[model samples]
Target chain A: MEREIRIDPVTRVEGHGKITLHLDKKGDVRDARFHVTELRGFEEFCVGRTVWEMPALTARICGICPVSHILASARAGDAILAVRVPDAAHLLRRLMNLGQLVQSHALSFFYLSAPDLFLGWASDPAKRNVLGLAEARGDLTRKGIRLRAFGQETIERLGGKRIHPAWAVPGGVSRPLGRADRDWIASQVPEALDTIRTTLRLFKETFSTAEECTVLGDFPSLYVGLVTDDGAWEHYGGVLRVVDAKGKPLVDGLDPARYEDVIGEAAEPWSYLKFPFYRPLGYPKGMYRVGPLGRLNVCDRFGTPEADAELEEFRARGSGRSGRVFDYHYARLIEILASLEQMKTVLEDERLLTPRVRAEAGINAEVGVGVHEAPRGTLIHHYWVDPNGVVTAANLIVSTGHNNLAMNRSILEIARRTIKDGAFDEGILNRIEGGIRAFDPCLSCSVHALGRLPLEVEVVGPEGAVVQTLVRD
Target chain B: MDLVIGIGNLLRRDDGIGPRVAEALRVSPSVSACAVCELVPELVLRLRDARRVLFVDADARGTDVRLGRVRDEGSRWGHTLGPEGLLELAARAFGSAPDAWVLSVPGFDFGYGEGLSDRAEGFVPQAVERASRWLSEGQVSADGA
Candidate 1:
């Protein structure tokens, strides 16, 4: 008898999705499919707008990481104008991006994934959440909340709002940083650093050597991220870098605007997200990973002292190559540390307070491309404008889209290893969801949709009869 | 200060009601009103200093404009935190949470668009009025009575 198990609306992630597991008569899992059910059509609606509005409009795509879109879109607009931004403007933008990374990565690790790590996976579905973790470990919960607030506060200070601040403009930022704002931001840095260090220590004590790390999405794949010309870890603006599974450089310093020459997007009817592949390797074979794991894998070293030390320790974990998806949590913590360090460095520099932030210019080119390493991974915003500076077309290669292929592959691999004889146990289901959580994919950012829907999982027998169902309301 | 946060994405039809209500109430000197795209945990910190907090949002499950007290209903691990989660975090992190309420306006047609449905738009005045009354009188009748 052929049986199918489905976990719909995978819980604790940003978007809506489901997993379907296929089993043969022998009760062995044969195949699996991860489906993204929501769609927003951001690309279609963005057409016909003025190029100046791209930064503000695209920022609304996701409330969690709107700053990422705002910065990337602004950079794209800069390309269209062919104007170099002022140094002070660049530092301001980098500060905003680092704030985003801190908040976003904290949300992913502490709020979303920590419950499963603290409470046993088989804990009551209702009790396996942040509130529950708060009851079990109040100190840790408080640290998570405060740490995230530090990031949000930094964003609110610079962008003027925590969710969507259109502060970044074409060729530069809209306003320069005031002394009061700089002082307040500087004061918050030390505590943020302490919080990240504590969280890293806790994580190392808890799950760094757990069995799940070896089993969940632990496989070799190509890694990609942004890197400075000097081979330092970068997030805001830099050339492309690709590395093989064994930490060998495949490509480096490729111009971001010419991404089409090296990358390809493949469409699948079953999912709304597109599979981005390395053009040289072709479709499934070219499947690579992005985000924290990918970013850490591609960078030579973090440019900061503390983050560099942590990176060295992190590298020692995987014998100089941290390719396991499980390491994403650790990488995210290290990045948080690095972001705080970078934030301090930028704030301490007096040049960031210069009055000349934006460059005045009209559109000098027909097409422009902007790229940034968002909290989730690498994000690209490409726009085509008419002579009057109205947008004719737009293509957004979001960070989540870049990891679509790897996510699907990870889901299948985990399902096959965990499920047997069609039992579909709660522990097994949790492990499968953990694989997806490792990437912390944002379905809301990846797929466009409105409202929060309940996640439902169902099992069907050979005759297509409902066998069992799990629903998270 | 009394804080009122309007929560929802303006791009989604009736979901924009919260932000629209906030925009309408921006001139009120007594209320510290802000329009946010969604409810996140950080909101608790922002609202911690307020004497009272009122969250105005669109409710697809509701049929009429309703005002109710916010309570701690536990927290989910996802990014979107509800009114209950916000209150809980405030209580735990700040030692005491402000009195909180939810002003839910019935909404339909939550598709991708910039404007609100006629039904949701019609309830805006009533929602704003109720919020004003709550601010002045320190109490609101249930179910818009």
Candidate 2:
């Protein structure tokens, strides 16, 4: 009498994933598992390549967040070369990462998750997409489009193009920000600021109830991200920090280069993505969430005045617990506000126009690890090269992979909440998919591929015979 | 706005004909050129204000360049929102869409890496000439003249 339900090709968010829910004969939600069905052995293939090719080659890892890889890989190379990238290049790299933060987050909010927020969860599945959201609120959708474009524009101005710029090199960047470029980039910030403010107000206003957040991946787990030395918020460069569900710091100022000592990757038979856990606690038990929610929990305050204010209010929404995974969407908006304010501060500096951007060097170290925050979460790139600078080993712990344990738990939580007593419908299906989208996962960044999303739910009795089948075409 | 978009993968041999032709086109004050791997939603912004736009890509269907206007259609999408979906998105969001045409250049090779095949290269000048005309004149004819 007990059966299993398979939701294949989970929709929205990024990449390809599926969820299998197991039920007792009484139709009660008994257990669930989330799986990553795609895989690309990215680290394995780059082993013999010259270390110098890493920044450019690894930039191709994920088109959505290549800047993260470019910066991370270049930072790793900088370690191998052992030269301090000039201040101007360092600032420029931060600028590009900020640009990345804006664009990738915009894509997650407007294009991927907006439908679930705007359209009712049970809205006609066909109309629950950006186009549908556009039909209802075209002006807002246009603004969203422009906001995302502004993020890409910032990158285009700095890296020479939005995706995979050849600018960030090992020792430093290949070019400096021109005065004209700075002025142009600076001019665009005010409108972006206005759009985000308008969006924040709308998200808070339109979300009239807190009922949705309570059941939507609202569970206790550890949170991890980068934090400034004094515990201020950070994304580009900072020490690794981990805070428990109660926001108590368990690990502080850990040398990111020594991440292996604390963070361990565990494999699950059903998924290609590794489950990364805190070493001190052990596998699955060491499970923690990352990305916006993690960063928000780990940081004491965003450095900017406006964003700091927003951060305080955002945290207050929890009342007496850790952040709800649902708040990831809210956290992205605050981060955008922070990024815009930060962009203004960076552009105002005269050093942005410096001609001395890069430092020259040869391989000075054998093993190097680059650590920083991708828009999604903390991304680490480790590379080992020979004295001749050819890569001997490479490892990449993508941001989505870090949240593997959290994502599966989120799916399980949503599935248990929605699927009860063996009842199934589209509403239950969407809530589950929406849970994954809340993370704005880039399976391409994690699994390194994108596949089609088709919906077909198959129910099989414990004897492995089909009990009931559902299809969406 | 007059826009010429060379759309295809430069890494896939002859499929890269699109960008090569875009590179050859004299995009100036009257026309702007964009070379992309494929169309995505962001390109909708560029299309919203355009008075005329031409999408150029290599196609295996013909031995010669064939051009046609993209039909106004449904707005479903995938990893790369094709030209039709992007135009549809532009129309939906902005209340109007640029007059858009797709020019598919026939090619013999679409293997890995850059550069067009000799046969694919042979058609570039023609594709470039037609794309230039479309962006400037905003015309569509049965013959693609």
Candidate 3:
């Protein structure tokens, strides 16, 4: 007899997600669903506040990725004032952004997803977390902790605090980095560089499974990201560009204020998160991706030397005329390296430690847009302010919102492949969740729609005994 | 020396009301002089030195109290150890844990939405009042002579 199995309120990962799988009479394949459960009203809340308060208020949306919110908000704030921040300010902001990327990527690899990869996917559920990984590989775990700590320290030194620092303000940072902080950041660069090398080596040695390499590779997606005028991935400030599967630019030199004309969010009754797509393309066709995968596919070259080497290797493995989805997974490590290298470049700059960090901007209430590359993906913050500086309207499109379509497609692909396995097991369902986990969607930042997101699953059974009983949350 | 502990996931809507209130108390005109440590559950070890303790957290009682309204806890409270858990964990690590009472705010929603519900918003002042009273009473007599 076969049934369905369901787990709601999936723990460990931030926010909530539900996993459901249906089994046939012989307990074989049926169907599966990975539905995110949560609704965020950040956009609505942004309606009445002042633009000045947005950088700090919006940053509170997610504790794990506040830097993204901070930098993104600061960028949007800059647009409204029509003031170009100092060069030192731009460099310092980039350094902090890199710090965020390093820490967040390290967390995703070592803390959240590593347990499944390192301890065998089928291992006991109890011992399949960071703690379990530590018990098995204490030295590696220690190194991971130190690496994350160093990244966070870099952020704190530059931004002034670990979680939500008030450093990246509208004009620039609140205060310039003093010599002590700059020297402190400089001293840690060598160790930081070493950690990046060690992490890449660890990923290479411990991971690199044939299944990982082949599973979601070669799939096509419309990729969008920010790149500097010199063709390097830009985290601080750059013109937005969209590239199709063949690595051909579809749109370039996009201004943030005009995003409403390019991007539009659609609602699906089955999920809480909204799926954002290129408005001109319509629903399914409009589906696009943003994040590490999208960023890698969209960029012509990485800015840093070490990252450029990894990017070259990534291109070699892609058999497609353009980049493949396979490159997206590989690019994860390369981007982390890029982030680290970028961190070093910013820390080594002497102008970053100047005494005057904050700049004065005359009050000019107008519409503004801010976009920055978050660890998860590209984030945009758009606001409309009155002459008094009070926010009149706000709209935010987060990285997870951008990746919703791709995630759904990936989940179904994984489900169709494993749902019919003869032995009938939960491994297939877990793998589907694992596949989605690679994207690291931030549901807290995505879920904001009216109405329920419907989910359905069917299970067949010969005698209808207890095999699997699952329900979507 | 006893301890006062506040625990809540600040990101979860009204669940964070406790910490917000505690933060307000940390700077309140009444309790400004007292040194109180705020912590999450994982870092409860910092409370080991206190003899008497006060714990604040959000609670759901099915009905009655308004959202955000702070209650002194009923006689037949069925809730788990609020401050007691921290003390217990501390005792396990060291030797002894302190005694404490939990101040609970009736919660409406702990969803991912922003801003506390009106019910929860209304209880902020009441929570502050209870904390002031508890602080004025102190953990216990300071007499060691």
Candidate 4:
């Protein structure tokens, strides 16, 4: 009898998504899919708006990572203006991006995925959540909250709002960093550093050898990220870098603005998210993973003392590329450490206090493209402006879109490995959801609607009759 | 700390009511008001010490201002959260949560662009007045009378 098992609206991730396993006559799993069911036309709405309003307008794309859009859009605006942004504005922008990484990565690691990693994958669904993690690990949970707050507070200090700050503008920032706010951020750094280092230790000591490391989307695929000219780990601005499973650099220092030269976006009917691949390699064969795992793989060094040592230890365990999606959690912790270390350097720069920030200019170019590494992965924003500086068209390749192909392949691999021959349990289903959690895909980043999180799995018999249903509410 | 938290997006027409009410309430120095796009678990820290917290949000299901006790119903939390969920987290993390209520201000349009629908705008002062009274005097009974 042919059967189909469906997991609708996988929980604990950003926004709505689903997973389906197609079974054959023998009930063996034949195929699988990860579908992103939501879409918002941001590109369409921004068509006739003046280019000057884009940074503030596009920042509304996602509340969690609005700084990513703001920076990318502002850079595109900068290109349109054909003006060089002041040094202080760039420094302040880097600080905000780093802060976002810490907060966002902490949200992924501690709140979302930790419940599965720490409380046992098969634990009671009702108790296996952020609330449960708080009960079981109160001290750790509090630290995670504060650590995230440190990042949010840092952002609030700079831009005056934690969520969607209208700070980063086209030529530069709206205002320079005030001394009082700067001092407050500097004071919070020590505790933030202490919390992240302790988190790394806790993660390594507890779950380094867990079974999740093997089955949770552990596969060899190409890695992609932004890297400095010196091949250091970068977040704000840098050239494109790609490394293969063997840890060899496949592409080095390509202009990220000309991403169309090396990347192709493919669409599958099953999902709204586009599958981005290396144009040179073609289609599915060019599947490359991005985000923390990709960042860790593509960078030669973290350019920080502590994260460098941690990276060395991280590399010694597997292929230097760290292809295992399970390692994203570990990589995020390392990046948080790197971000804090880098923040310290930025805070000490004497030029950081300078008041000269924005570079006033008008539309000097028709087409402009901006690229930056968001917390998720490389984010690109391109804009075409008229002579009067009104936007004619825009294209946004968000960080989450870059990982769509990898996510589909991941869920497919997980379904086959766990759900077999038409026999599956809730724990097995949770394992599949846990696999999706590994990448920490943000559906909200791609499309802005967020539905309720109720994972409903249904099993249909050969005649399309419903045989069974399991729900984790 | 007494908190008046406005949870919604300003870009969505009537959804801006929460922040508008919060913005209106800011004139009173007695309460600390903030507008957040969403309710995250990190907000638990702020809720930890909040003696009274009023969560003002746009209610899509109804057409009038309704003030009610926040039922402990946001149990299955994932990416999205609510006042009930944040309170649940506050209890779990800090052993206590603020005495809280939901001020559901009904709205007509939730589409893109700023400003409230005319009808929703009319309800703003009424919602603000009620929320301020509740936060300051604890006027609502335990049963939300």
Candidate 5:
């Protein structure tokens, strides 16, 4: 009898999804999948809207990372008009993007990922949440909340409100930063640094265990992210590059608008999430990863003093290389530090407070593409406008879409490694979930829906015989 | 103290009902005396403090309720509060319960099109009136009665 295992509506990230595993007669893993239930049709509905409204409208995709959509859409619209945005406008946009990275990553690392790290992977499922972690270690949870609040405050201070800010507009921002905003951000830097250092220490401690290092060590997959010609990671502005597992850049200057040419989307019958593959390599060979792990593998350096030091440590820790999956989690904290450092740099640039912000341009063309590094990964927004500036076509290749292949690969690897110990074992299931969470996918941004952290797990024997099941109701 | 939260999406047509109602209460003399707020889930903890929470959002609560019709919600408040895991864990951990109600706006087209359908928008005032009455008159009983 072949065994089967399933996890439904995995929680703490975004959107709805289920995972299923199939075992052959030999009790060996034969197949696995991550199925996304929600349908993302933001692109389909964007049609007929004026290009000018893209920034504000696209931000509605996800309540968590709307700033990413706002910036990416505005950049794409700027491309259509063929106008250079003012320096202040660009700086303000970068500040907000950095703020997003800090806040979003904090939410993922402290609130979502820490439960498993702190309480142990096999901790009670019911007590494996923020509140549960609070019960176990109140001080840590409080710090996590305070740290997350700082990130949200950054959004509120600059964008005027945290969740969705309509400040970023085409050609530039609607307004420039005021002194009050700068002072507010500056005042928080010390505490933010404290939180960053504390988090770094905590992460280092949590992940230093030999088991963690070897559990998911250096799994190979193609990496993709935005990089400058100098080979530095450029979150706000740069060309998209795809690199193979061997650390060689495979392609450069990949236009955000021409994503269709470089990548392709394939639908899995079991999942609403589309698997995006490198067009040149085809689906199976084209598997690649985006987000923290992929970004760490692709970028040569972070370009900040403290972040540089941390990156060196990360490179040294990954068995003398910087490309391991362990580095992905560790590097996320470093990137959090990098983002804060970058925020300070961009904020201090006096040009950010200048009066000249929005660079108004009459829409001279109908087609445009915008791409930017969202907190989770790279995001591309492409739109085709009509003569009246109304959208005729919209195609969004979100960051999560890019990681579909990598996620599938990860699920299989985890399932295979843990299947020998009994597929239904709680510890194994939790670890598998932990590995997937390393990707930190924003499914809500991809397919629009919200509410509920539902998780389901099932195990079956050979010939599809049921063995065990667990669900977080 | 009583609380009213508007939970509608401003872009999608009828989904705007909650925000509109919250906005009306914020300004209206009738229900302005009570505590009120507009938020999404990230602020769930901030809301857990409320003695009573009346949530207003667009909902497709089966076919019985007419679009925009304001109906007294039943005891299904547990589902909408937080993610299932958090909600379940909080309920088990705290052993404390709060009074709550959900005001569902009968939604016809929640598609990507602009604003709520005319039918939904036209019924906004009635929804507001009902929500306002609940805020003003409902008691925050121990059982959330």
Candidate 6:
């Protein structure tokens, strides 16, 4: 009498995925699995390519977060060269990463997930989208669009193109900031700051009382992200930090090059994405969360004044324990504020206008590992190259991969609370999707094998027979 | 000024038509042309300053290459906004939306890889000719002829 429920092609997320819930004869949820169906084989194909081409080649992995890959790959190249990037180039890289954070987080909160937060979850599926949000709240929609544009414009100004710009090179960036570009970016900061502030106020007022905030992926889990030496929230360069669910620092200031010693990837048969876990604890038991929630939890404070104040208020929301996955939305908003503040500071720095942007060097090392915080979470790129600088082996631990284990657990937790006696209603189904969306997992970035699997849901009986099938094309 | 934007991934087989057409049309001095991999919301700001805008892309729904005016439509997701969505954003955010058109090239092969399919490549010249005609006609109309 046991039955299975599947939700295929989880909508409103970056890439394709599904959730399968196993039920007992009593119809209570027994287990849940989150499946990533497609694979790109980036790691395999990247081998034998010249290390110099990594920034540009890997940038093509995902159109959405190519900047993250470009920067991370370039950092790896810098490691291979064994040369420090100039100070101005470092600051410029930080600016570009902040722009990425702003655009990406805005896209997640406003475009992808806002409909469920603003419009009722059970509302018409047709009306539950960015267009619907625009129809109902035009002002908010406009602000979201403009905020995203501000981020994209910043990238375009610095990197030369909106999507894949090969500005970040091995030793440093390709060019320094021009006066016009710096002034234009400086001019846009005030409005960008205003938009984020307004968004934060509105989001807090609306969702603070919602029941979804408490039950949707609210369980405690370990948190991981990068932080500056003084423990400031950092996106570009920092030492890796891991904190337990209780806000205690389990490990801090670990060298990113030594990431293999601290973390390991575990593969599951049903999923192409690898489940990355803390090395000592082993497998599922070492499960930790990343992205906005992890970054905020792992960092001690935001260095800027306004962001630090916002961070204090954000922390007080959970009474100092802000591990709830639902809080990721708020964490994204706070990070946006911090990014804007950091951008303002960086743009005003005169050193960025210096002509010296890159450091020339030949490959000095055979192995290199680069780590940085992508919009999703901590991303590490490891490469082994020959003396000729051709890649021998490549491994990428994308942010979504690190959150794979936690994403599965979250889906199960939400399903247990929402589904009733094997009922697969639309509302319950959406709640399950909402849980996954809360993490904003990018399957395209995580899975690097080979498959073009369609999104499907199969209802299986206790005897392992397919009772029903649902396909989303 | 008038703008022509060709949008699609150059890495995807037939999807590179948009950029291909844009590249071919770059010789025309009457309008500005560029190729982008995707149509993002940030395009609205760039469109706001233009007198007219044309977006070119490969479409599986089309049987033949066609050109038509852009219309405002509801969007289901955030990232997949098309020409119409960008126009709508322009109108909503800037209070003025430019005249916009979408030049859709019918494409059969959209699989992973570079270069256009033979069928899609056959239509490239015609697509370029049609886009050029539109630009020339627009120039004549704008000149008060």
lDDT digits (tens) for residues A136-163 of candidate 4: 9988889999999999998989998887
TM-score of each: 0.88, 0.94, 0.74, 0.91, 0.79, 0.90
lDDT of 6 by residue, A340-386 (tens): 99998898889989899999888899998889999999998899999
The DockQ of each candidate is 0.33, 0.66, 0.06, 0.62, 0.10, 0.39
| Fnat per model, in the order shown | 0.31, 0.65, 0.00, 0.77, 0.04, 0.35
User: Which pairs clash in the backbone of model 4?
Assistant: none
Lowest summed lDDT across 10 adjacent residues in model 5 chain A is found at A447-456
lDDT of 6 by residue, B23-131 (tens): 8985444478889888766677678778888888998878887887775555434447777767766676567788888888999998999999999999999899988
- The order by descending TM-score is 2, 4, 6, 1, 5, 3
Quote the positional error of residue A238 for candidate 5 in Å: 1.3
Docking class of 5: incorrect
- Give per-residue CA lDDT, model 4, range B5-48, as digits (tens): 89888889998899889888844555788887778888898888
* Per-residue C-alpha lDDT of model 2 across residues A1-473, encoded as one tens digit per residue: 89888888888767788888899999988888888887776787788998789999988877788899999999999999999889999899999889899999999999988888888888988778888888888978998999899999999999898888978989989998888989998999999999999999998887646786655678888989999999998987789998999989999998889889889987755677778899999988999988988998999998999999888877677773355778889889889999999999999988888999999988899999999999899999999999989999888899999998888888888888888889989878888887888888888777632221233566879977879977643
After the best TM-score superposition of candidate 4, give how far the Cα of residue A74 lies from its true spot, in angstroms: 1.4
lDDT preference between candidates 2 and 5, better one: 2
In Å, residue A210's CA in model 4 sits off its true spot by 6.7
lDDT of 2 at A35: 85
Indicate which candidate wins on TM-score. Answer: 2
- Regions of model 4 farther than 4 Å from truth: A447-473, B26-30, B59-68, B71-79, B104-113, B135-145
lDDT agreement with native, every candidate:
0.84, 0.85, 0.68, 0.85, 0.73, 0.86
- Candidate 3 matches the true fold with a TM-score of 0.74
Between prediction 3 and prediction 6, which has the larger lDDT?
A: 6
Strongest candidate by lDDT: 6
Q: lDDT per residue, candidate 3, B23-125, as tens digits? A: 7775433232222223322233345445556666677662322222222242221112334333443443345555555667777889886567799888888
Give Cα distance to truth, residue B13, candidate 1, Å. Answer: 6.2
lDDT for A434 (candidate 3):
69
Per residue, candidate 1 scores C-alpha lDDT tens digits across B12-40 of: 99999998997888456657988888777
Candidate 3 CAPRI classification by DockQ:
incorrect
The alpha-carbon lDDT assigned to residue B28 of candidate 4 equals: 58
